[model samples]
Target chain A: MRAGEIAGRPVVTLDTAEDIAEVKDVVFSHDHGYLVGFTLNKRGWLSGPMKETLDWSGVRALGPDAVMVASGDALAARDAESGATGDAEDVVGGRVITDSGRELGVVTDLVVEVDEQARVVGYEIGGATVEEGPGGDRRYIPLPETFAVSSSALIVPASVTGFIRDDLSGFGSAVDEFRAQLEQTS
Target chain B: MTRFAEAEHTPVYSKASADEIGRVIRYVVTASEHTVAALQVGGRKSKALLADWAHVVGFGPDAVVIDDEEHLRHPDSDYEQRVTAGELDLRGRRVLTDTGYEIGALVDVEFDESTGELTALETDRTSVNGDGLVAIGPYAVIVRQDAVRPEEEPPAS
Candidate 1:
């Protein structure tokens, strides 16, 4: 499920089925790729901080237009009111760097799997110069590699660079090699 | 197999009559299996059309051929409508193993672009190397943990 789908949907209590608030941003574990919970804002309008977060366990049902929760008790304060910002960092524009310091490109998007929870699986990267023009060479980098995400960049190791393929289909060999390398080094 | 991004705008046709129907504006992928469930069709002067993968009979380099235009219809069920409405798109959704291990976010999907048939989901090394997609839902993607290769261990001190 795209993260955008859950945004702005009604957050209802299970027992009361009351529309308590609206879903704001889904807070997920970047490392584990699962839903941690959801941040909520008052229904309508995009102003104000999201003070409440509902854990995934509290979610009873995810419907077409509404998110059903067990109770208002499921709601928890974020960072205990210290103004914890949501993960809205448009990492799409972040730079990509290799462990050997070769600059690859910028992060265009993240590929995730949504089953029991949301998890990040890979990244879409492309050169800054070729992004908008035809024939831009975009590539996908799978997870479990030596990579780091800071304020404005995503860094990977040099070994992972060999796995970079132009398209998903052609990347099969690269994926197998990367997996093999991980097993050997482990 | 074709990427979701490239699958957009691929020409579509009717197999029975071999008449051009429309271009694929977008796709409706299933949440659990990570497969193309339906295609949203659009073209100049044509009414909106949604065709399920079940109706597709063949795929070509230039076109996706469905049984017939009579097979196209607006999604009727809430689940199907949600898929058609982009509410259940798994393209960028995150995934996890049944054991709660972090897999990664879904980056792309590989499928028969012309046939609208889903083939596989590419999430990350864990999900990619796993047996296959076991479940796909709004919450998370689940794969066989046993199928997952062990992560690179930190060097022994």
Candidate 2:
């Protein structure tokens, strides 16, 4: 599932069955390919953003309908470890550059591996760098296990260019192969 | 429970002299304790008069009863000075959750008439339980995220 799809999902506490909050944005740790947590908003129309952040470890399940947690206590103060991380929206529109200094394309969306763990696996690229092919204006590039990411660009290994898929249908296998290659090289 | 609105402007009487001293003005609240610390009694000609909550004999509907006129005193502390100037009045102050969301502005405060303990914080849209109150600052009243009840969910299909 795309990280964008998770935004606006209600966060429910399994113990009380109370809908405590709504997901405002999915914060991601780009360098580690791990989901940090979700920034929340109060659960009502026109309710503004909340101060508490929900860490991924607090989540019991990320169901299609709602994100489930053990209890309302799961929402906590944002500590130094999870604080200041970028959300998925921050990565969108940022440049995706190869480690070898090749500019690939601008990031359009983030593909998350929802079943295994809610981790970012690939980037959906669009704009001038995308090839004219079956995927139309977008292309999916698998993320290496570790990479460098700044506010303006994501730096991936140059070998990632070879594993870029046309769409999400075959993106999982591409992610696996890309990681395998990185492991072999290191 | 009595609302601050209902208590304001009510006449204050002295039990010892059996004479009316002043009218209730604004309440001096201690946000940390979520209780009324004192009462600002005005409508008198001399300097500002304040009656600590401890001095209040009863919060009757007709009037606030105090032990005597001596119980009323001049504003002594910086906190009391702010209260007398209407700086710390909770009404019209915005209510913010500890998680950083501004829910609404405080409309009225409800408290126990006998003990002066806060019972609820009311906004135009909702009422937050007093137990969830975290702090009341000059800028806004901060509360726990769960203080305001969430909107009822649409029935599941």
Docking class of 1: incorrect
lDDT for each residue of candidate 1 in A45-163, tens digit (9 for 90 to 100): 65555677787777765654567665688888765443322342345678877778978787766654445555555566777533443325777776553334554877766777767
Chain A TM-scores of all predicted models: 0.63, 0.88
Per-prediction DockQ comes to 0.02, 0.02
Poorest stretch of ten by lDDT in candidate 2 chain B: B148-157
lDDT per residue as tens, model 2, A1-186: 787778887776644345688998888785676888899999878678999999998887775556767678999987777544678878899999998999999998888886545688888898887779976988899988776567699888999989988878978999999999999999
CA lDDT of every candidate: 0.62, 0.80
* Model 2 per-residue lDDT tens digits across residues B26-66: 88877668898888899855567888999899898998999
True contacts kept of each: 0.00, 0.00
Error of 1 at A144 (Å): 1.6
TM-score of 1: 0.41
lDDT of 1 by residue, B1-157 (tens): 6777676788889888888888887777554454677788877535546888898776555677888988888767666665556665666775544333445677776676555555655775433532355555455454544544456211111
